[model samples]
Target: MSAAALPAKPARTPTTPSARLAWLDALRGIGALAVVAEHLLPWFLPGLRPYWFNLGIYGILVFFLVSGYIIPTSLERHGDVRAFWISRFFRLYPLYLAVIVVMLALAWWVPVREAVPRDGSSVAAHATMLLDVVSVGGVADTMWTLSYEMVFYLLVTALFLTRGHERSGLLSMVFAAAAVVVGLVSSGAVLAGGWPAYVSCAVFVVALAGVVLGRFRTAAACVLGLMAVVLLLMSSRVPWLGVAVLAVMFAGTAIHRWERGTGRLWPVAVTTALVAISPLWAIESGWWWVQADVWITTIVLAGATFAGGMALRGRRLPRVLVWFGLISYSLYLVHHPLLKYFVQISGDLRRAEVPYQLGMAALAVALILGVSALSYRYVERPMQALGRRVSRRYRGGLQRGGDTGVAGQGAGDHGVLGHEEGQVPDRVRDHVAQVDPLR
Candidate 1:
């Protein structure tokens, strides 16, 4: 794969300041449905489980790639670290905490996996959402992905603060190479057993907190290096999967950089090919990735899907799908728990006939969508408005506290989509990302 094979970039449009990126919304919509289908079909209608296509993993990797692509754009588009966190906090936590309550209540009735980490550490680690990378059992199995997402956030923020975000392509290449080499040489290594994982997790959390708290900039770099090194070395349950996931995410970020014209397409192509093929080395000579019947199929399909989306950037998509994208975060959160509870309450999932189970799955998706639409309307939208309001007040208030942000008004926002936030939170909604509403 090379730059020559990639699709031509779309022309930039002259639009209003508040213009929405429909392509990302469309991508998120399709990806969210794929995830819902993947989870439901396999769980209920086991007879129809396709051995060849890994819809769940495919959906999730699309999410990771989209997150990688859009998150950095959101961050740099506003160029205010505080405001970015505010948007993320309101965007994610309101729905996340609500889902937690639902998950816990459902667990009481439905008999979900309640595997907590030893010694109550799971509580603290999960409170921060760094459990899996820190080697703690997640509250939900789906949550494992969030750990990698959080780490990616830290790494990107560090790069931006250190004025190195423009080099994301090189970094993506480095992560991909590490994935290949590490996967090939050995399975992988965890940092330390037991308490050390917790301790390191705590340290990283505190450092991140400090950085987000508008403290010294050095704290940002410190936490970034510490967490990155630890994550690179820590593989725990799976072998090179962590590295591979990170590589995939960074590959997204790399593509984003190229799309914005600060980077070359060649590195992005190289990184994607590396990420698509990296798993071959990680799969023990005999075993294969749980996501795929054939690993290459997963990579090829994902690449094609993304490239196709890129090629048709300005095209119009169905209204239903775009609306689904609007409520994707709520859908992603509540769908799993509702489905799990439905199974538990129904009792004897395996005993149900394929036709009956398929009907139930469809109903579950319908219910999830209805509830998600309401959640998005009543919950996410209002909270997001509050977040933006809070962002405005927070940035203005920082001046009173004598905390000059990462950079002052005069600094030109330099990287991809980076802008001079002279007003800080200028067109703050630009930072609102519909992709990977994984929160």
Candidate 2:
């Protein structure tokens, strides 16, 4: 059928279970926890460790994969490019802005004897999410990842707006690939000139991975395997490649379903064994490869763990982790600045001994959790609701103007409500339309 002549989707039943994509939530939670562990590494161990076992880095790969999987789904479901952008802005911007503002306030007000010197340029770049582009020192080291995320958001938004037509997907893929080649070639030169070259390279790798996986599902698995080998070889030269590799693997895994049986145990066992051995090897040899191995093993373990969790779909656990997943983004953005502030406030305590450092780390985590919960409950949730309402109204207006397309469907369908596949009831469609007057 011609695209314009396609019929509207039939309304799903209201009594049907809601689609809740818990896997994404669980993955997000895992990412957040990995970041927390990465930050707390120094406190837990002696000396200034590079924090290579840092699951947080791999968690970003998961983030990218999750976004790739969900954005297309959102476009398919919502059918409105404007609404998708609106929802994304609502979901990400408020918390991001709030974190920036809070960080600024702390930087301005907090007194510290040994504060990292803040450059005006750096502050501006970070506040605008243009730190990587501007080559400014980030307000927080972790903010580097946010720069890549912002770029990815823009690219994905473009793809969503174009609705996979105009060969926009192909165009995006080409651009992303070009970016990687350029970044890798220019990174060393840029660094020699005193710029943060790794940031560009990292962002390009992420974008390239997204494009490759989004475009070629069958090759996705092979690409991931190849990237893993490259990452292992280049761990010291381009540590970020390791992250890209993990991301590719995660994306590949998400695209394919492995048979559920006792046979899954072998890979899980090997992955677990590798993860367990990695840290020990890292501590003993102080080799970067050991560190890389640790992260790779962790990513494998995380994948296995996610599979296991999915297997336990219906059973209710403590849900504390799931709750953490809900606020994971906020937690991640806010954690570093909060940690910096804590270090400043408790400098003397931190320097006391290993036990004291550990204690401070615990206290920092508690504060982050508390602050993130409040941010989610009061700030993020309300903004999200407002964004959805605005998107619905805007799209509804478009529909009334005779724009009868799938874009009339609300953004909630694209995994925003954390719904899973096969869970969206036909009846719920009517309810959504009645309630929002836009879906």
Candidate 3:
């Protein structure tokens, strides 16, 4: 559910400062806090442990919805599938690769390495970061979400390149309905574990082809289509929850399309309703179950929080919340491994005293925050700037080289989803005009 950066910045044209996307930052901050709190609070405040009302689910779902709402705009901003991929690559991979290296180094000294499945094949599969579709365990507990995020990217690109992007609402509804059906009958088994490495490797190669081979538009589109199909069909470590999550993301894209004038609000509303009601379907379908009343209460509360956030989207949040939003991605990525390491290191402290437990938990959280802040500054932010620059260069090269394809040509790259070809409404245009752009 984490994002590397916000959409590319827009040309500065001053407007009402308070009527912007600080609420989105606040939402991210809240989700980050909820997740972090879910992890940390249990260590010190064991009485608050309630699996049925897991705050982690709430936070992650919020993050997912936000991604659905905003991510498509980035594709439209670049107007080139290849450019978008390049931007995403620079935005996401460098830091991810860095973390992987760090984790591998830690394996030399700590038993933490065993947390991930150990095998040559499994290691190769994870190196691709599409482990969900490939049906492999993650290097860390949270890395599984990255695979789903990758699938969303592939699907969005597939739809956009195929000119079916405007039908996002319809597709979201279909996915939700299908998910309900699948939930009722599907065993949620792994598709096939035998060739996961090969399939994952092929997808990676084809994805690169789709990005770089602009002249072969038909082939690229076909590759994208195949990629999307494979992603949706493959097994997930989380089973039916993965399918449900995709539906929610598509619902978000539907809302973005409505705001862009490419689709209608009613369809968005309907699809969103489906996504909101999915947990009940999930529990009833026997895919998973929690305490009914408690789970229902948590779901309702999560929806209310989401609705409230959307209603107040135009309002600016406090500086601290905005700051938290800025560092949330880094926080999400780094916290779990740190938590695991400390939980072991401080085993004796857990039995020592209540005060020690509180102190230890607080200290762990503070250390995580401190490390996350530094990582955001050194890793995420620089890479984001580099991504923007690389995207621009790639687009410029395509223009100069006269390889204008489905992505659109220079100057002709009108904002297809917006009012004018190149012009977006201020609401969408103001997407990147913030102190720290919400990702």
- Steric collisions counted per model: 0, 17, 4
Better candidate by lDDT, 1 or 3 = 1
Is 1 or 2 the stronger prediction by lDDT?
1
- Model 3: weakest 10-residue lDDT segment is 420-429
Candidate no. 2 TM-score: 0.62
Q: What overall lDDT goes with each candidate model?
A: 0.62, 0.46, 0.59
Q: In candidate 1, what are the lDDT values of residues 166-195, reduced to their tens digit? A: 776787788878777777776534564556
The lDDT of model 1 is 0.62
The TM-score obtained by model 1 is 0.84
lDDT of 2 by residue, 111-181 (tens): 32121235443444544353434444344445545544444344444444344322322332333333334
Q: What lDDT score goes with residue 424 in model 3?
A: 8
For candidate 2, the per-residue lDDT at 38 reads 55
The most accurate candidate by TM-score is: 1
- Ranked by lDDT from best down, the candidates are 1, 3, 2
Across 227-261, the per-residue lDDT of candidate 3 in tens digits comes to 65555555554345567677767776776665456
